[model samples]
Target chain A: MRVLALLDGTPADPDAPLIRVDDLGLLRGDGVFETILVVGGEPRELGPHLDRLARSAAMLDMPEPDLAAFRRAVDLVLGTWSGGPEIAVKLVFTRGVEGGDGTPTGFALGMDISPKVIAQRAGGISAVTLERGIEPGLAERAPWLLLGAKSLSYAVNMAALREAERRGADEVVFTTSSGSVLEGPTSTLVLARGRTLTTPPSTLGILPGTTQAALFRAAERAGWSVEVAPVDVAELYPADGVFLVSSVRKITRVHTLDGKALPDSTGLHTVLDGLYESEY
Target chain B: MRVLALLDGTPADPDAPLIRVDDLGLLRGDGVFETILVVGGEPRELGPHLDRLARSAAMLDMPEPDLAAFRRAVDLVLGTWSGGPEIAVKLVFTRGVEGGDGTPTGFALGMDISPKVIAQRAGGISAVTLERGIEPGLAERAPWLLLGAKSLSYAVNMAALREAERRGADEVVFTTSSGSVLEGPTSTLVLARGRTLTTPPSTLGILPGTTQAALFRAAERAGWSVEVAPVDVAELYPADGVFLVSSVRKITRVHTLDGKALPDSTGLHTVLDGLYESEY
Candidate 1:
């Protein structure tokens, strides 16, 4: 909720003394965004965040913005920030708030830097299933309606997260009403098997995440198999290791779910965090 | 789309300089807006629009803006305009783009007067039955998600409209997957039976329309029965009359759906349009 308002390249008064007409993202919720952790003024997963941003924009049918300029905007704010230590940087890019007649205009981008990180809870996160993520039709038949886009229309996503938090958990994992596992609100779902680190395939309409990519490489280096497959709720709860992966809070482990304790292993979390820090 | 940008109350450069963070509606999509049709430099439905804007803010859990000041800002723009035949006026209010963590800061209020009007077709509209309107569970249990408030998170609503337009319709009427009729992408769905003009109830989660309320009043004065009830796709195609209602384009007739011609209702369209203009 704490955000820095970046208008053009300069940080403006959060009270942007403006009677603005267009904010398509905030209006129709018509845009895409990303959240990257800034560690010592460097964005945590630049390449991956940009990659997902482009994909989500396409899903929303928005005319893509200049990705390079967007990256520079992030860096410009990071360059000027004097806040000590590390913080989460959130970038929101929306199709300018006009043209409901179906023609897209330019885009509006806002950046919020150094959000207070809830230091990773030592014991790990507790989560529960939410049916909001279910696709009503067959996967092949479901039109990708904002599913792939990290559009500013994220009220439901935030709502689901709150639902999980209210239930005494740090995060929530989305599930189909049929109980098939979907991804976390802002993170990718990943778990370790006997020797394999597995996550859901992107074709399941989940955002293709950069953190999971890096972890895949890390898993390879640790002599583990990496597979992208559909995972079920039953399988997730009993996994050898469970965690949610994102750019800022690299790897948050799930210690419990629905009142049951998940068998834990710090091996995946430690190794993944180590890899994320060293590489990015 | 061409637009005009104003800051606070002054006309400023679109690229005006600013501070770094505005954690307002931009990040959370926490805002509400209304687009009114300006007829002869006068806002046609200012009272109803402001009423709905306040309702949308309250639904999304944000405080309402000062309507006296908001109307003043809108009037300032309208008063200055040289008389035009007609124009579109948009009013936007955000929890003034900065404040709390995952909470509303305040809101930004912006208004734009555009030279646009609803592009209605000569004969009328055709539509497709998209099953994506209301989620199955919420459609029955939590009607709260669908009724009344006009929040800015409208990606899917716009998408449904786009899909209808693509199929050569001016607008679309959404149907439940199980075949119950919902409302249009941006208008209320109505069926006329003899002297009765019936629309779907807000209990079904349709955005209640100022225009629809006017229609109900006019129908009553004309000695017609006015009803609000659920209809199915079959009833829509075989109805005594069908129309989409909104602020600017008060009543657009639905002439065809799929390939079947609706029973010709020239009498209904003429009666409705006359009542809409003279009374509404």
Candidate 2:
């Protein structure tokens, strides 16, 4: 089941036409979006996702979105959703019609979570590392690149995932030109080395992982060390365990990288899962 | 007046809703597009633009767009156009609605050329060079980056143009990390030094400029030298003249580059303009 709502809290038919031909969001991908996970009819980490969405909008120099309206739209979708406990709600805000006034096009869409996400969380996934083709240091120096912003121009990210699929992998982990591990095409890279959990810092131009941050904060209170630092591709092979974290996908263990089987980390997985559930 | 047509030759209301909320073109920018200049009801270089559109689709691993359908759509829009002598006809092809049996979404839109484009063509433009944040050699090595494809994922390109606007410039010329000149945000870089016309090679992962190719082919026959080579930022300072060329904007002379006045080439501009008109 799927539900749709306008930013003004109006319910829209999901299967009907919803966007104009001249919308810049469709014409030039001039937009920002966020996907949040819903459990038991409640959206998880809604505030953080909204914050990041605003940050992305600011990075694109777009007008700031109305958070109060977005909250109403989300509530509308959730109230209308009659499906399962788990749903993925996406908030879309775009620089609207090309020749019209500067009013933005905004909407919230709710749908059932993909079976693939559920399967990956259960049985893990295989991933391949692909070159991101940009230097890590260029992120801060080149703000126009929009490296850290979760803009709707994700064709390259989708292409990277297809490249991974062509290589018989389920996901892609993007590495900088200098072989520094950045993040996944749609998730954040997390590596566990015994008692420490480390992820690449957002300063490297990758998105700051909301799920990882929440988990890390709770883990610190639960007596685990958390570190944010640069990670290298070579470090993945020797790590105790590796995972990809996202809002909808949660934590998915990478079972094999480049077809090399990795040692299982059943104990750590349980601990991390418990931490995430308790924190949320 | 503006006109819109579906790929099947059906005319549609440009002001009404024409896209679904789940269209990947809107959600993820997973699509391809072409903007062709129409003069006297004729689309300039239609064949080449369609060829490039198909190539971009191939690069994105998308389903081959139906060219015959696109042709009919373009013809329909042209037939219905009641605009002035100049119009910009844009063809958009997307990956289609998410989870909807793999059907693609496509449309052709025609609108009057922007007053800004006309103004720039008449009086020229000021441009600033911005770092593209990628190595020149990465184009071939990183195909998944979609460097050569003119995909709809243009948020970064739009951002670069905004950055140029912030610097009080009308356009942006992108340079590689090592200071090798690439292309403009929406145009191709062409530098004239004496009798030689030079542009950066398309092998550098930039889109092969259809307008530049047409201009070069005509210039060679007009007894002018043409070269496709790596251009450095330093070369722009000593060039006889610099221009940005595109299908819609046509040829726009860069009056000032990075706030420095470039040498005038009135003779060459007239000669090149004549050649382009005669060839087309």
Candidate 3:
């Protein structure tokens, strides 16, 4: 079953035409969105996702989103959702119709998690490093680039995924021009070395991964050391474990890099998986 | 008055809802578009704009757009349009609805040129040089960056324009990290030194400006020299003339750069304007 709700907490027909053609979100991709996982009709990490949505809107110079309205929309959708093991809830906020009033467009949609995403989580994925063409330190200085903002302008990310498909990989791990490992197109990179877990800092202009933060918190309680630092592309090959994490997918191990098999980290994977399950 | 048309050449209500909420064009900015200036109900440079649209689609790995259908839509919109001095015709083709059949979505919208656009063309504009964060030549090697494709993923471009406004400028001239001049967010940079006209080449991964190409053809016919080369940001300050060109705006002189006044080039401007008029 699918459920859709407007920002005002009004339920909408999911199959009907919704957004206007001239909406800036459709015209120029001037929008922000969040994808959250819902288990047993309960949305996970809704607070963080809404916070990120507001942060993204702020970065785009848009007015602050009404978190209460978004929360109502989410609750409305969840109220209508039929029983399901998992659903991916998406929240979208746009700059509204072009040449019209300044009111923004917003929506909430709840749908089943894709089988591929679930399969990837269970069996892991292969990724290839693709140069993002931006220098490592440039994004922090260039605010206009909107580097860390998870806006709807994801054509490059989609293109990178297509490139990964062309290279016979399932996913892409974007790297800076100088070979610093940045993050996945839609996920965060997590590296395990011995008892320590490392993730690249958000200061590198990558999205601060919500799921990764949750996992780090859980792991910390479980006695796993956590570190946020710059990561090098070369370190992936020699790391004790490498994984990609997202809200919907939860956690996915990286089994191969550039067609070469990575060393198995089944023990670490089990530990991380248990940690995530225990907390979430 | 505004006119809207579907790909099948059917007219639609401009005030009505059109695109579905799940359309990938709005969801992920997976789309390509073209804007053509219609003067006296005739679209200027329709052929070149359509060609560029197809090229952009190819770069995005999207299916080749049916140019005949787009042409029909444009004709339909113009036929319905009441008399106007100028109209901007926008054609959009998107990857269709997410999780649906593989058909594409297309539309043509014709609306009046904004007064601000007309005013800018008549009085010129001031621009600030903002670093694009990408290194020079990196775009050529990183095809996934979608540098030249005019995709709907323009949030960064919009953000840069906002940044320009914050700096008390009307427009933004994007520059590479190393200070090589790129193009404007929505236009092409044209520099005049002595009797020669220079524009940065598409090899720099900038869009091959359709208006600039037409201007160059006119310039060549007028016995002026034209050169396509890498331009430095410094050239704008000392050049005999600097201008931004787009299909709708046509030609706009750059009166100031980073708040400093630029030299006036009335003679060159008149010559170029006459040349454009004579040809178009």
Candidate 4:
């Protein structure tokens, strides 16, 4: 693993102690983060990831991110991990030490993708639907809720995934209080039915998935129609195919929902994988 | 500020960077925390705070916290700041470096209470009611959401408070989607109706407040009726008095709700303050 800390746009020694216990990011989980895949020592989908990071920072009322500082840190960390297998480069920016000038703490870390995530891509995953406790169409009215912002307060998301695992499932798809399919805990829910691809709209309080956005762009070029629509849980089971899309995991087919198998993805995987591979 | 990092029953250097970047507490906000008021070098309401911490740890599936380790760290940190004005001592425990043996990381830090929070006690806070984005009765069914747990994912709570300030208010009182008053961002909601005190039930997904619990016990002994019930926002405006109760802020009366002055809290404050002081 390689890490580089960006102190006010300057790269600091990775081995030196950097984070203070008083950082609001650690103390109150007040921060924003983005994970980009590095292929051949280069950050993939850099533009979209940086854009989302800035948006998250704005939602959290943190100062606008210094993208140049982020780029420097990413470049340094990736260089340190050169020649490694594909790595996940994570960019984190937090409200700095409390009672200070509120300078943001920014850093980048590069590490090999978790084997478990890689396995999910190859084996597909069994997903269970869980209630997200909030009703649909509430995100817009409650900006203070920090909906659609990828804030670091992800304990609920992690807990939902753990709940799925305890139920003998590998992943989770969250549904709103109204029984509408929202999105996966860490991934976007994209469904395909008869050549049309559909994903839940970000207006429903889901993080706009970077990989899903990339995949949609690629899929569109490959002559597939993509739509952002509200999906009900009942619609997922009847869909011809469903997949969870994320940056690190890329595109993963949901082999089963609850306990029943969805349609197999023999040809769809070939087409989607080719699109993802040809992107860079 | 005095800080101590406890590693498995041992006190480590406070200035040494204790948390790794990969700590799930920082990465996923997978942690629990408590802030207790230290008066004259003694932690007030220690038993209830620890009990709440243990409950929070259990809600997050963390290993049992070694209370002995916590006590030792607190003692050392408090001793470091002996004779200082009353301070706020914070305890944080997180599921340590992810994918490891799940060894928890614990720490204690003592700092003088923020002048702003101390000022609130003198100048009562103007509060606003904001929608909490969830129904009142959903927490029990959605344990995965960790609604009642004082998990570290306080981004939304903090955001709500910021939203209130932006609207020219001093604090926030969260209301459920059904219009029931929930709690403050970091405090418990307590409303005074004559000699009876009512608080929103914990079943409504609000954290069970340590200071609020202590206040209720003290109130009962002083001939005040305490009821744990769900309060609607409508009732707050007509109440005899309203207050946001927390350990650090002690018992702060809410002077206004949504720009409208609540009833003057002369008698209620006298009684509650007397009860609070008599307890300690």
Candidate 1 lDDT at A197 equals 85
Give the winner by DockQ: 1 or 3.
Answer: 3
* Full ranking by TM-score: 2, 3, 4, 1
Top-DockQ candidate index:
2
Best-to-worst ranking by lDDT: 2, 3, 4, 1
Candidate 3 lDDT at A208 equals: 91
- Candidate 2 has a DockQ of 0.91
TM-scores, all candidates, are: 0.82, 0.99, 0.99, 0.97
- Arranged by DockQ with the best first, the candidates are 2, 3, 4, 1
Q: CA lDDT of B278 in candidate 1?
A: 63
Model 1 C-alpha lDDT per residue in residues A43-137, reported as the tens digit of each score: 76777787777777776666765677667667666665666546566666666535446433322232343233245624467887776534534
Model 2: interface root-mean-square deviation in Å: 0.7
| Candidate 2 structure lDDT | 0.91
- Each model's lDDT: 0.65, 0.91, 0.91, 0.85
lDDT of model number 3: 0.91
Better of 2 and 4 by DockQ: 2
Query: How do the residues B1-280 of candidate 2 rate in per-residue lDDT, one tens digit apiece?
Result: 7999998779999999989999999999999999999899888899999999999999999999999999999999999988798889999999999999888999999999998999887688999999987687788888999998999999999999999999999999999978899999899999998789999999898999999999999889978899999999999988888989999878778889999988886666777777777866
Report the C-alpha lDDT of model 2 over A142-236, residue by residue, as the tens digit: 99999989999999999999999999999998998788999998999999998899999888889999899988988889888999999998899
Specify the CAPRI tier of model 4: medium
- lDDT-wise, the better of 3 and 4 is 3
Docking quality category of candidate 2 according to DockQ thresholds: high
- Best by the lDDT measure: 2
